[model samples]
Target: MRFTTPLSAITLMVASVKAAENPIIGLVDRITSISQDFDNALEDPNPVRIIETLPHLAYDGANLVATIVSDVTGWKNPLDNDDQLKTCATLKKFATTEEKLLTAILNDVVKVATLPLPIGGLIGLVASALKEAVDGIFGFSVKIAPVCSDAANKDKAALTDLIANIKTAI
Candidate 1:
């Protein structure tokens, strides 16, 4: 009976940790999805609605990323911290540049989104430009392949380490 009680308590604690981790993982998934969708939308000829929608989506995703980072750090509200504020400002600037590029791409798409004929050539040009713009702004390739790969595999380990660091701090 004594051993059972302690074992049950340990199980409960493990379950609690898993539960906490799930939300952070879900947030990461959501961010990745939004980013990929925005990237894919740039390749469509009629992309204005997506272009218009992307800023808010990206902002929401960023906010979620910040929240998860803060949570993993055990920081009550890292958004209010000076360093985090600076990071947010930087992210906002990059996001603005990305939006501008996407808007330009969408301009071409807007001309053909509803059209029956394919606009593959124009879309290809705009996608290339958009990729360049995003790379310039973010200092990384805008290829979804690398980004999604990192997000799926590398990010989990990184987040796990981050949480461990936070636990040590506490």
Candidate 2:
């Protein structure tokens, strides 16, 4: 009974750890973290500070895309990035062109985006997932149209052209 007790305890620990370490679960946590960071940055008075935060946010976002693609392809996320990193670079470039406007856009995004970063199938279901994840990260701003709505809503435009462009890059 003593031996069995220790073995059961170990098994429970391992199972709990495994459940917590599930990559999709990790992905969801990461989404919430980035959303909080972006929201906090938006509240700051300085937009340059916000710019500093954007790259890291974008990279994490890329990693999320990579993770999703990897889930589908069985390759490591590093290999099957689906251009998520490139999308980050593009965002950096876009920010450089107009920091003030981009900052406002990001603020709007933080204000309106739904969280937990959707993960629809990457191939045919790309639109829904990207609309929720990629678009949430990089689209839906005051400058862009439609603002925010339910991801599954058919009548409302969930993603702007910017959203589509970023999703394409990723």
Candidate 3:
């Protein structure tokens, strides 16, 4: 096939279509759903379930931060894919915002979960309730590829800090 139109015109069209289907959109959707879940979980009057849930939630949040960082900063072939480059920037901005929001939710949940409780009766109840609640609210299905380096990427420092804060809060 010979180029009937300019080569750049075809390239732009293909890239725009690919950008519309970027996988980052799926990640953003998951993050949005989970963020809303975290908000809803916090509204529960019982603190035991929230206590059990935040640790797993924080673990999953770490995976998201790692993937978001890798997607934005790990591109070795940025020039070869305009759609990836464009979506990388968009995803980084959006994921960072959600990360902060989720961190705030975890922080508040941790505070409530830590409040002093009567020693005997509710303690056993808290333990039993937590075991059941873990599977209900804190599990995630997405398997984010681990970021290659444990060393801090300067570009992803904010996410790193948020992940750490979530861990601490939980």
Candidate 4:
């Protein structure tokens, strides 16, 4: 493929780059979906069922956060100051529910441990869930830490505090 003009080639390159970058437009919606999922997962009365759902949700949540952080760091249509603040606000709200789910997982582990008769495979299942939860939390924090560390946004103070709260939550 050969462009007849340098300007056309440059235009095409810029267009492709923009298309490849993470779409900031739907960030809040994705965050909202994850947050809602967390809430729904917590409503389950069965501890084991809750444990089963949490790891998958956390994985999805962490991946979204990682994608956003990557876009911000790579200078690929980074969120504006207002959008950054909004994103953090949504995240802060999400963190509370996340903390609840994490806490529930811990409590479930204890409950399973104290059962009179150990159900076959229950221990292994709980262990896998715990491992996945830890991995997801670590991945999320690692990505979010960079966003907080880079002080380019006007909402750095709030963002930093929010990130700290999130880190503590899990």
Q: Give the top-scoring candidate (TM-score).
A: 3
Task: List model 1 lDDT by residue over 61-157, tens digit each.
Answer: 4454454444444533323244334443434443444344444435535544555544444344334333332232222211112333333333233
What lDDT does candidate 2 reach at residue 117? 27
Query: Per-residue lDDT tens digits of candidate 3, residues 1-170?
Result: 11112343354355446535664454454344445445554655776765555444445445555555555554333233565454445445544665666566556556654666332232223222222221111111111212311221332445545544544553
lDDT of 2 by residue, 1-170 (tens): 11112443454355446424332323333333444454454455665654455555555556656655554455233312433333333334333432333334444554423333221112113223333553333332111222222221221132344344333432
Whole-model lDDT, model 1: 0.38
How big is the positional error of residue 50 in model 1, measured in Å on the Cα after superposition?
A: 3.6
TM-score of each: 0.31, 0.37, 0.45, 0.38
Candidate lDDT values, in order: 0.38, 0.37, 0.43, 0.43
User: For candidate 3, what is the lDDT?
Assistant: 0.43
State the TM-score for model 1: 0.31
* Per-residue error (Å), model 4, residue 161: 7.3
Q: Which pairs of residues clash in candidate 2, taking residues 3 or more apart in a chain or in different chains?
A: none
Tell me the lDDT of model 1 at 63.
52
The regions of model 3 sitting more than 4 angstroms off are: 1-20, 48-80, 116-155
